[model samples]
Target chain A: MRIFETPLYPYERSPDQDAAAPARHPVVVVGAGPAGLAAAVDLARRDIPVVLLDENDRVSYGSRAICFAKRALEILDRLGCGDEITGDGVTWSRGRVFFRDRRIYEFDLLAEEGHRRPAFINLQQYRLEELLVRRLRDLQSEGRPVELRGGSRVTKVEPAADSVLLTVETPEGPYRLEAEWVVACDGAGSTVRRELGLEFVGQVFEDNFLIADVTMKADFPTERWFWFDPPFNRGQSALLHKQPEGLWRIDLQLGPDVDREEEQRPENVVPRLRQMLGDDVEFELEWISVYTFQCARIDRFRHGRVLFAGDAAHQVSPFGARGANSGIQDVDNLVWKLERVLRGRSPDSLLDSYDAERVPAADENILNSTRSTDFISPKSETSRLFRDAVLNLAETQPMARPLVNSGRLSLPHVVLDSPLQSPDADGLPGRTRPGSPAVDAPVDDGWLLARLGDRFQLLAVGIDVPDDEPGLEVVGLPARRHPLLDERYLGGAPGALYLLRPDQHVAARFTDYDPERIAAALRRASAQETDDS
Target chain B: MTRLRTEPNIPDGDGFYEELLELHQGRSKEESDSINARLILLLANHIGDREVLREAMKAAADTGL
Candidate 1:
């Protein structure tokens, strides 16, 4: 019989006029990890409605990442959570490396000056998550609530010409969510990235390492310690970091042939740690797991309406503490742009810059972390020999110190090719240009791109505003405070001005800060309106 | 106790000496002296407070190296 199947339900129109309107949220964030949470908080603070969904019921347990760089702390400060985090976290001003019982090398993170904060701080991942969750909840209490749905697993994401449709399942039932933008922060095994059919290309290390969290009563120094060839295991190495609550994190290299199940047992780890500690101290086992390093990044971070951040976009080895810090920066880069787009102040192409600026940063960080990994834990015989030779030279030669210090590592600052930055005119060295250091400049409190302002701003430094510069606000700096100026220019005063973006990245710098040039540059940077004229 | 002279070329302070220890078990006289000099400077930088910086510099300068 040719019977037409009954439609699921007759479409009923609501009496309300808005019922017929298409569903369009300002922003939709997939995954509730640090990256997604940070994005949601920033957007919500800007009075933008955000739908943040995660598959897990609560923050994931186990110490995923513990170290945060100085820049990351600056970001947290802007988000209004830095004080709490810094107060709770341990600041390691120094670290030491050992070869068996003898001390080999040491690093001082507090080498540079004018750092608004310390170089690095160590805090457990769970504590960070707790702080973020509390802050998000507090924001919700203030009326500008971020819509966070836990256990609402997203199964399918289809990007439309103007928006994105996400099919999510929850305990109540299945529902469809439509968003003007979608951010996928679901982590390394990201379903959103896979469904989008993006390629995550890079290298995966062959060697596996065991990470053990232990409760210890030992009297070891509070500093982070690395042992190259400690007693018991030659060639193989170990990393010991002190965590809060009298806990310690130990990373030990496991041979390829070692049995994962056997080595993971508490019995195996306890003895190994004891061997390293000698007969002087006592400790108890807490948690043990094996992790393999991978240096991979998505070729394209954003595809149409779907955007990726954190481990979903890129991942690096944990050598230089770049993995989590970079992910947080990704959120910092995107949140402001997403806010502008949602507010209809800018076009979607604004999202493209996120990819342009961050992808290169990710690649550079990966390369750096890989270099550190290879040097500390050489994979090949040739690399091992080379490292040994370099160390030997550094021992005898006074000039070889910076090379070794550089090898240890530092996080990189972002430099962009936007229109806001002034072009390099005179061949001056080590000067603060667009995307360069703001070390010597006099930073103001509400001066947009001033010192420790964690948001992007347009700095019209050292410029006299002509009558025509109305929409743009300009701040003038004298030559004495602004060291980047050429001595010959502006009668010895630094005539150059810089336009800093919200993320502290310089979009453009100008030698003159001419009203017409500065306004045009700001327009180009905000991507607000194309400069056809 | 033997003293080492500060050299102009080296950048980091005694931290380099500590790092050198990681690479080589020990070094020659020249290496030890230079590393000590670098360490003193690095520590001076770390004590960024002007008073602290000066104190560290004075201590290093006065030490028999």
Candidate 2:
């Protein structure tokens, strides 16, 4: 029996590089969307050759999904663009839910403490694409070239045993390019997913929602304003959010039966706005569009040499701002794994966990977005009654405030069982448990895990393991001078040590801190070779 | 709240609630849309406020925003 089977090929291919042809990249990314561009950036930063392709002539226009979670901000920080994006984007700290003209509920996103980053930043998607493009160009100028091919449409993808052959149709003509790996980031209706015969299953909401980007001169607060009921607009609702520019994004809910063309007429929207705000407030319409929400995911994110990221892998409703953020996170999870495999630091099986970990994250986001949609647009009488009761209870009961505020739901750090987290015999509790978002933790200069560089870290909280632990390097998190040190780590539970991935996600947690057990778990998490094996 | 429709002698209240909860959780497109339409109508009737209804309709129109 063959223990190691070669990657299955879709067609036969030559092994030798053509002497007359221009140089080919190690990785060829199709679609210059957030996911594809991010992957290219990650690879380029690691001195890897990458070629990014997109069919569009220009960056994505108008406002697409613009919200970024704190986790995604950290990824951008790793790429050296986090501060620039965060500095320019709008930070929303509060939200309000209105029932007609009356305020039903309000939320303060800043209520949580100890966050290194803000809860979210709203910036135009185009600006992000522009930033990626500029960064890619700068990297190319610095000698680590990342070839960006725009107006180049991928007409065919033929996966060989060792490489992927792509036939692209440019303005000049059709051309073929070969690479060791391919990533497809071409929106929800991904051609690559179809070509590979992957299943994308989910529900598409039937209601048509009209979004109008306009400059509004009104006295409404800068926070997110959601109206469950607005006077003069029975059976309809509206969302008003401030954008980075001196503009507001106004989303008006439309029934499924309404005609899109008639509803888009400026005459209809302007009058409705005049009624909501006084008649004298002037506004300029920048763009108007109708979008239908959908929740979907491809059955499999990887197929042979090709992988799907972003909307290609899954799509979520815009309610929770999960679409763009989740896609960016997908690339974050994939890029390091791909680099390790390419550099021979890890086996190809490391790529398998990408599907296992990210697919669940995608599913969770989809489910959350779907639940939000249902709550906002309840179908059954029972659901409506329940929602109303919850709202009413929230108004009187101060304790229930957090449950009503859904904005707090963001992606949690993944706690996988990996070799990076094996602890030593002298157990330290807080050190071994998976690390969560330290948004509220007090900053201490000497805290080992806190001060560890923004990369993968092995924290030996209590055990004095020599700096080596097989495939992992252990660093002792020194006991703090603070009185709370014992209470925080060893007091409540078994003092355990933890291994954290570069993305600040916990890979493994060990209670006993035993060297042998720690090593075994670490090897398993990283998929490294074990002595027993 | 005004009751639009009620079934008499519905067997196993917990089981029935569980099924609806599952359907809601699953969030099938057809199921959600029908539910949304019914909710809008029910709320509109309950409030008996044309202005509020109109605002909801307008909000629904601005889906992409």
Candidate 3:
């Protein structure tokens, strides 16, 4: 059987199952999806015990999320699986937008040269999960305190003042677990969120999309091709993407009122594919499903001791590939704060920054995806008129090219007005400003981000080297080492010092070397002190 | 930073108005709406100054009211 078809981590009764008292862990991740696995791996890497519970033993059944963006890949690199994923996935940066029969214009998502990873990669969700599971197993072999229990369903969640009680159901029997903190990454149909009586509040788009993953020997280049009102699917949009193997992902708009069962039938889907791909092209359907997405998120991610991450926290339409990518970002933002709080290194209130920062990120994702959805599936006649007009003008007009919204593809959202970020003191580059994730550049040995690793670091660019401070790792790089580094980090300034958070987001920056300011920013970032400025 | 000029700016105002009406003469209501949308988009792109566009949009929105 294929890896996804086989049980990778079958249910085995744990010692906690037979204990007279419920065994407690430092953290209990309620699902083994990408967010949960990343959270568990991060916790274990920090030497914190984590129990990852999942409802199934295998990876995701189908190729659910295929597009992994660069920021998500960078986060995976910190988790020790970036090279494996980028190596096994099909990388592409160019996307062509089609209006009816003719191509309107194309865009390169990432035009810069110094980045370590590409703009995006198309890998089967199962394969990505397999890689993460392999990483989890590797962590296990290293005597890390992380456990993956498959076939374990979290049936109930009860939050308390200091702990959360979970009732999990398994093949053997139902058992209880108490966790100091619980992270729910149980996907859109989240059981934990439901049990807590919380709902994702936002717009539910009125459209259906049929996804058909086909294996073929076609010679399509590795670029994203999006169609608006195509000939095959009149008055609708379609998407074609290349995957790692011979498989290709084709999404066709089925409108809002499609009969899901009939539309997903191979008889109806194959003819549509033939019309789009030409009649002589031979292919076989690998998996087929119809989905209607919602751009929504919960009110707050943190609910007392139980925190929600991934789809349980928020969800966006899959057009921009924001769903899984943002979910991975959610965990990346979450795990660091959680680890610090669990280690008694930071106050519990520091976890509140996760909500403050990520909720805005979720809102940004929702806004962008909702705009893309409205453009692709115009809600009213007036909106459709404007959308078509832009497309009509985009045929020959370069100005109209930027107006055509074929799913404003996913990019990392900067955390704006965040409390963790210190206000900009010197006029450095805005791209690497406080609250923006660190931009990767070439360093002495390898990439800049690879050296930054997953910790609080003081990056001194084009300036004199500083000795390591109490809790921050000091990294000094000369401006002459790389011109792109100077362009990205220093801009017009002579030199700069940046205090980077554990997630490699800029906490603060300065033109002069002031250890006092850097130390205060670190304290404020960890919630050890209040921001006075 | 240009403000929306409420006073006449086009040198040949009637001629431009006549030309605009002539462009929509043979079009249906839906076609006119589409053509107007395309025209607005073209003009908006040409005038890439966002503050001027914002002022023009506000002036247009408050015209009848």
Candidate 4:
């Protein structure tokens, strides 16, 4: 059953209809959703040259950001639209946790078996912006240098002192642009962060989520259930999930002075979807919103030459779906350092290490979305008597179920002290140390993140690498005895030597085989000689 | 029971007591006693001021036992 009542994609106003000779772009990209079409399909697979603006040309009607994790589907399978969005998403790994309605435990974000990807996938933010606009129209019909437009609108942003000037405003008229970098995957009220006013600090959770998205057909169980206070809707918190074709995406929790247009009527969402999907099943509603829970960000997602990715550089509290999966992992860490500082191969203070590694990954996604919105809206009464004595000792204690935070879900953001990582050299195992991430297993039958694509390699599991340099790519694993690759790349060692990054992360890992510590961790992961190894 | 200035209002108090000892670092002592009973019920629900939370739980049980 197809339902995507959100369509609008038509452009060609000859580069801002010949914006009276403003031209000076190397990348402009502002809000084309899903972190500006996954940073214009990872900078047109590095043939760089983007423009991508968007004020409205549809593609975001509802079912907004439906859990995409798995490192944002391996940065959308390295921006080539991961197998057409894992064949239009729906994968799952359980997730139940209820309290006011029993069933207290069931998780399996739990994955194993030589990974390839599948820790999440619910698909729909208008099908992840129509599969990143069909991979930016297949990199604009292979003539690369993306250009996407769509009713373009930006009404100002100047940030100069080197370059960044824009004015746009189209549907036929007004224009003037320039860039040498200016990305703000505009969302979360970011008209280029309000045309460069900036200062977006944090916290706002006062509670008030509605979020509907129905279509129903019962026989549930696609997982992720979460309840808290639910006797078929009473004292707050609900959330359910399924999305993909015959949809389902609940979300209740309407407190803190509601009446915002009578709980977004459909007669207040059909008696709370007939007291939580039951009462002779059969549903309808397809999109709704009430929202209210901000966890702000942007103290710095790089300024000068402007750069900020996804929900305009940080915003959370969509419990663990970490708002567009941390804005598509902030366009996979600012499109490989804005393609090595736009091909000058690094320098431009390597964009201050993408605001020194994404302001501690946006303060760890605004402190896990403000501790899952204070453990699902427990603003007082001693945080709901310690979140109901830790969900009544998590129903029967499995050691209080990882302190039950229904949304401590999204992971992957471990730049363990990153200045582009290079320390770890001792006997391995802090689970792929050196600003972590880059673990997926199974090799020689494919998968170790499909040969760590998106380049910048040096891998080596049972060890023996360091040979393909000239833009280094080397991989050599042989000595395999998989078990999640000797526990995520040899910890009880037989050999190891990672180095990675081109957005796979882990820029350092050695147990032996030190070609000068993998050339000083590939020159401290491409910012070049930072005095360390 | 309202004498609660909550001694040392955080702010780098030795890096917030080394991230509150890295939040019971790597838990497990019954998950660090259910993470100190869910971090003293999330700091008694952020000190929702019940007589300043029974005077900071009787000065944290009479100054650390």
Candidate 5:
């Protein structure tokens, strides 16, 4: 069955619709896209009751936001659907850049060994949403308090003294609901954001790219192929990527002033595809869309009890596949903090760190996305001259190859200056330093990341962890067990202690076991101590 | 820190100028500009010193001012 045509979550009348007063929920998430679905799944896993609302009952129509990076896959693993999604997608680590039909350079994203997931997986965005919906179903069958209200459109959002009021419209009627915490994961055009009168702030590029997803039976290697000024589409760029189920995504850059409606017509699009793919090739167009580059985001992600995440919080040009990937990272960074605040384990002020950490991450994503867009579509003649010069020299010169920016594929933004991280007392590898996400290594029987998510973990290499400490799980590894673990974590130090946050980011590290320091860092990480002094 | 060597670094200065002009020979104005840009990039990469590049840029911009 075509999943896109099927209604995965049909609308059903809920008891809250008939209640006399607005029913209150601990957490209410709007929009069932990648970010919203992920946020709901995370809260349910932590046993925090959450309600997810979406205007549509089925997956999104087109294949939007296709590439899932390794860090996002790792987060999905914590959500319990990583392996399934990874197996069902096309995994690729190599990409080739070309100029006028001549291949110039190729790159391997994951050159090192001992990594579990590939650098990226190309799957239709609909498949990702379906998998998350299935995961939500699995959690529900296990008696988790999670409700998915499809066809329930959030119309109004009003902030109160301690709670947020939401008006949801459904086929049955409109209902009023109150939520202690509201997470808006709606897409670029977010109704929740509009109701609250919040607007995004950034630059918007004046260029349109026509994306055509075609299905054909051909032998093409699963790799990204990017071209600058190809013969088929002269004076502009083109990109080709392999997707699962015999689908190929092709993006052709159409300059600033073009009729968007006329360009997407099948008659107009078929000729463009025929010129590029040749007349002998048998293909069928699956989806066609014309998207403009926009690298804009909200100034802040959090607004009192109403918090915004995903595209509702930020939007970037689709150059580096940073849109949905960073959205999932936003969910990963937020769920744990919300859980702690709800359980009285952390103060509400702890939620403020979400703004501090994620805003910087969003800005970094925007900066990278904007730079990539500029390289791909040079606005002026001098810019194009320099871009072409670099591409020309890149054919034989290695130095010029690094200057060729074909979307510096998405990487996890390290939270370097987070208030949660305790100052490092012991020198170690910078890759696994404080404020960086935990790097995975081989443990005794499985991977190290397998044992370190959803809660605070203390990883001790050749050190005895105090077992009596509450709220901290300890995983002890013998000395020199794995060379990667030694190089990445120990870094010439015989033994060390590391504290990991619930999201698997490094919080603190020490050469010797110090309970007081660990306790203070934990307090700081949870926002229990507002002041460092 | 490396300084921009304004003194005679190339032993055959006239020969170097002749060769550089030959590099842009028979090229249009656009092509010559592109060749100059590429040559600058290559030389800047060979120097591999940002301080020297910055000083050279400042000196080049100060020409005829």
Candidate 6:
């Protein structure tokens, strides 16, 4: 009995087709996945009018992208969907890695940190998209300048000098749409990317993996459990994760030369599941699919008026849960820049920093995912030998435990040497450096992240920022020395001031408050837009 | 420990070789060499043992020559 439910929304052809003149929106978002929905919601919140188009009428059917990292949840929080998501999603921050039958180590991602959100949550992608859809509808009901049109497949894209022209095919007929900027979030085989003739380049593993979501009544704890070579699943790697609603995602490694069609059959899959969980453990399959991991990304995320995001811009192996989490981060990075550019607060070239910043983020994800794939499915005999040696030594040696690579789990990547950041002076804490996402800590009655509230602010940790700056929002956190805060934010010092971007990433930090550097960084972050409004 | 126990490590050597070939699919020799150089350093750092690394070097050198 498959338990996952997918309901389709009604899709009607846009009335704009027969209008007297084509309606021009400030932003047009293609695809309604997490990335596109996130982009739409973020833009709408910024008072930008947007039209969201998707070919399909429903959320994702399967329990795809189950592990949502905290950073993504924060981004979703900003878009008004985080509380509902984290409320229902199973939260976990610890995992165990096993080599063969023996458990080598148990790792805790955040050992001791008091924050509003947990380190991670396990909810199906459909559940996530459903929540986002509800949020979009709420915004729509409130008359917030967001239009979501389903079953509108973009058939053709023409990139002009000023704007991009689109031809979308709806059930009624084909219609022309134009926008000042097009956000191509139409996923991996994106029609918009194809129309532009852009290439996605990188590594594709030859081996196939079988991912199955099953519903069962078992007492499996909600921790990511991985095995390199397990007794039950003979010689190949296996991963087990518990999603909400008693659903579990199982990934079993299928080596090269597998008959993928035969492997995916329920008869074949059920037996493998029985072997992995014992024969007596009853379960019914909800969804099953076969996939090959590829670590590929485009050279740039921005192209003229058409910007690529999510799977359209980059893709990685599902090893580290980087796929959707990084995609959400991509949306987070792009939306602010897009909003600034749309508001005329920043020049159009400010959009280029999105590419500069997120390309490196995508590359980091690709590189890590590629390494995890190589380790899990070792590419050579020598590499496998080395992997085995490390796994073997990991049992007795603590140093070898760190060397073991069982999907180095997703962490929010800090932008290294971003041109938008003000350069760091000597002796500042590394946790919240320029271009790094501000690490959260406990403030007076709530979490520090809840206090940040998604705005460009001058943050004064453990002290008060001098008043008198008109445009800057100065936040003062009292000097109460918790160990975690001291180590991460203060670095055993009393106070430090930080200039933060709207995304809560540190733009600059200093021991002494300097208004000139802060002003300079604000200008650089705005891509040299010097006019003080 | 057994000195240089050379057995099949990856389940399918040919498949893994295919992946390696695909990694360098579109790269020139120079770019591929540079990639290999970077990979060598990275893997060497991971291994971090003088004797085993020496054995690996000799085995790899002995293969092509």
> Which candidate leads in TM-score?
3
DockQ of candidate 5 relative to the true structure: 0.70
Choose the strongest candidate by DockQ: 3
lDDT of 4 by residue, A413-444 (tens): 88867677777888777878887778788776
lDDT of 6 by residue, A1-533 (tens): 22224434567656788876666778999999989999999888887999999988888777479888889988887788889999989978778888887888887767455767777888999888888888988898888999899889999999877888898898888888889999999988889998999998988778889999998867766688888988766668999899888889999998888998999999998987887777778898987898876789888889999999999999898888898999899989888888888888889888888998999999999988888888898887567766777777667666667767767668898999787888785676887888898887876566677777666788887766677654568887755545555566778567778778888898888777778867776787678744546
Q: What is the TM-score of chain A alone in each candidate?
A: 0.86, 0.85, 0.98, 0.35, 0.98, 0.94
DockQ scores of all models, one per candidate: 0.03, 0.03, 0.91, 0.11, 0.70, 0.04
Where is model 4 more than 4 Å wrong at Cα? A1-22, A32-98, A101-209, A212-229, A234-250, A253-263, A266-319, A339-341, A346-394, A397-405, A413-426, A429-505, A509-515, A518-520, A523-533, B1-65
Give the clashing residue pairs of candidate 6, or none: none
Q: Candidate 2 falls in which docking quality class? A: incorrect
- Chain B TM-score of every predicted model: 0.43, 0.50, 0.88, 0.34, 0.89, 0.78
Which digits, one per residue and each the tens of the lDDT, describe model 3 over residues A353-415?
A: 999999999899899988888899898898999999999988888888887886766888898
Model 1 native-contact share = 0.00
Q: Give the poorly placed runs of model 1, Cα more than 4 Å off.
A: A1-23, A391-410, A416-431, A436-496, A511-513, A529-533, B1-65
The 10-residue segment with the lowest total lDDT in model 2 chain A: A1-10
Q: Docking quality tier of candidate 4?
A: incorrect
Name the 10 consecutive residues with the lowest summed lDDT in model 4 chain A.
Answer: A1-10
In order of appearance, the predictions have TM-scores of 0.78, 0.78, 0.97, 0.33, 0.97, 0.87
TM-score order, best first, reads 3, 5, 6, 1, 2, 4
Root-mean-square deviation (CA) per prediction: 12.1, 11.8, 1.6, 22.7, 1.7, 8.8
Better of 4 and 5 by DockQ: 5
Interface RMSD of each: 9.2, 8.9, 0.5, 8.2, 0.7, 8.2
lDDT of the candidates, in the order given: 0.68, 0.68, 0.89, 0.79, 0.90, 0.82
Task: Write model 1 residue lDDT over B1-65, tens digit each, in one string.
Answer: 22223345467868877876775356776555545555644554455467656654576678897
Collision count for each candidate, in order: 26, 58, 0, 0, 0, 0
Q: Rank the candidates by DockQ, best first.
A: 3, 5, 4, 6, 2, 1
